[model samples]
Target: MVKIYYYKEDDSPMTAPHDSGEPVAAEELEKLGVFYKYIDSQASVDNLATERQYKNRDYITLDGATFPGGEEALNAKLDVFFNEHIHEDEEIRYIIDGTGYFDVRDNNDRWVRTLVEKYDLLILPAGIYHRFTLTDDKFVKALRLFKDEPKWVALNRIDGNTESNEFRKEYFASLSS
Candidate 1:
């Protein structure tokens, strides 16, 4: 099941209703500008490649998989992304196993913490200030999506980023026009 939590950008939990109840359809998430999909969890470890194989001719894709190194390793990577950073390209993942949270910003700049589990495919728009973390179990295996070979660099918000300067937000927003 997928869960989405609304929070403060600083990572503080929201006082109001954060968990928006049970997982809903990806189309529902689309309304909130999130791209999500549910697939076969028991599929092959390298499934995302096969999955992307059938994309329309005009749809170009380049991606790879990630196996979360349990708690310690996840925490190490967390120190990078969790600094509340933004990527130049969309951050996407297809969960092969385990669970984790992708904390993104709502239009109002508050955080929306989305919980992704096995079979869940999550796409966080580029330039969106967000963070990532695993659940208590400290386990996760996922297929990462990319437009091309990724730079693997996240421009942290702490380094002089402002709410109004999200280029990827406008980039995708324009596509919807």
Candidate 2:
């Protein structure tokens, strides 16, 4: 099941949740411009592809399918992914297997963590500060999507790049409209 909650501010493991978990509703997520969908796990890959094509995610790359260097390599990738950052374009992912948490900064600047599992499709609007980390299972297979050629650039918040970013401005403007 998909779970959305306010992330606890602490030094706990990324996958650990707070006692309350402060659940968030789907409508709240929509207001933040986060799109989420759940398809039956039994659905064929072709069906998922077709649905994605309809949404303009034409480029797809699978990660965690064949980890040559094993879990350590996957951990390295996740370490990079866990950094809070914004992308010039939207970040899209279709969870092919396993579970993970995506922490997105809301309008109030609070962290909203969402749990995504098999068959979950999540799209973070361009310029939204977000990060991802796998659950204790330490395994996840995801199909990253892009509209054109894949560009996996993360403008990290630590770089102070978000304030002047065009996409970031547009995203905030969209919330007001």
Candidate 3:
């Protein structure tokens, strides 16, 4: 089952609900902006080739079925987009392959790094400064889903305190490990 964290206009900032640990049906996926889908690792590999062919990038081969370039491209195309800053609306995503990291600042002022892999899902509410990075040699893909259709916004260039940014530091530590 897909877990959803619903927030009304008057509700407080929300956190991702716990997963029911059940598989999501395809029919339900159409309604929600985010849902998880699991594909055989081998099938994921084949799909990558197909995607590359469709994009006319034959020279590019996906490593372990991960498509960071594709994800980045799709994200770039979204109406509102930003990196390293807080967003104004809830952002959701479903991991479709490999693994990726989401760095988030919780209400407690503690930074949290969530490691998402195939079939994992994530939801981030507004006003949380976050960033994403893919692990090397990990072929990961995810659907960038959003509640607001026109949610892309470019963040102004600003720096946050690295030490205070717990999520960011934890993610970097994982890379080194």
Candidate 4:
């Protein structure tokens, strides 16, 4: 029952823009199969506490759960460590609380800034260079699901320096300004 929305090779999902809001409903989530889930932001904190019960709950490699690491991991203050450039095999995210923006460079070289808030699910395919920054509010908590067993790849760390690569330069330049 997974719903896969494929963009044309010329139109990348990255760089697409969207408004922030509540998580997608359970029925919609079920259709995504193991793709993603946008945890409801309006849910009481007590209800949100049971997020872990859904861990490893699906057969797909991209199983996701909101607030996976708990409130401490999510509520921590935002820092540069949180500002990162990543390109993954497949990136899936579910917003559990707060709001943020994801800047992505699509295959067509178009830049899209997508505003995400509670309950918004975002999925990005491989080879897209992207980064995230805190919203003006500076508070965000979400579940990140990766198709790869070990989900994140720091391009700066892998490539050694952001300046050495053209893609890195473009990525940083786009996000910074």
Q: Evaluate model 1: give its lDDT.
A: 0.61
Which of candidates 3 and 4 reaches a greater lDDT?
4
Q: lDDT by residue for model 2 over 81-176, one digit each (tens)?
A: 899999998787888778888998989999888988888888899989999987876767777777666778899999987889999999999999
Model 3 off-target regions past 4 Å?
A: 1-83, 154-177
Candidate 4 residue spans exceeding 4 A from truth:
1-84, 157-177
User: 2 or 3, which is superior by lDDT?
Assistant: 2
Model 2: residues >4 Å from true position, as ranges?
Answer: 18-20, 41-66
**Using lDDT as the measure, what is the rank order of every candidate, best first?**
2, 1, 4, 3
Q: Is candidate 1 or candidate 4 better by lDDT?
A: 1
Model 1, range 81-128, lDDT digits (tens) per residue?
A: 567887776677777777777777655666667777878877776666
The runs of at least 3 residues in candidate 1 whose Cα sits more than 4 Å from the true structure, single-residue gaps closed, are 8-28, 41-73, 161-177
Return the top candidate by TM-score: 2
Show the lowest summed lDDT stretch of 10 residues, model 4. Answer: 55-64
lDDT of each: 0.61, 0.80, 0.44, 0.45
What is the TM-score (0 to 1) of candidate 1?
0.67
Better of 1 and 4 by TM-score: 1
Q: Using lDDT as the measure, which candidate wins? A: 2
Error of 4 at 143 (Å): 1.2
Model 4 Cα RMSD, 1 decimal: 12.7
Q: Give the TM-score of candidate 4.
A: 0.44
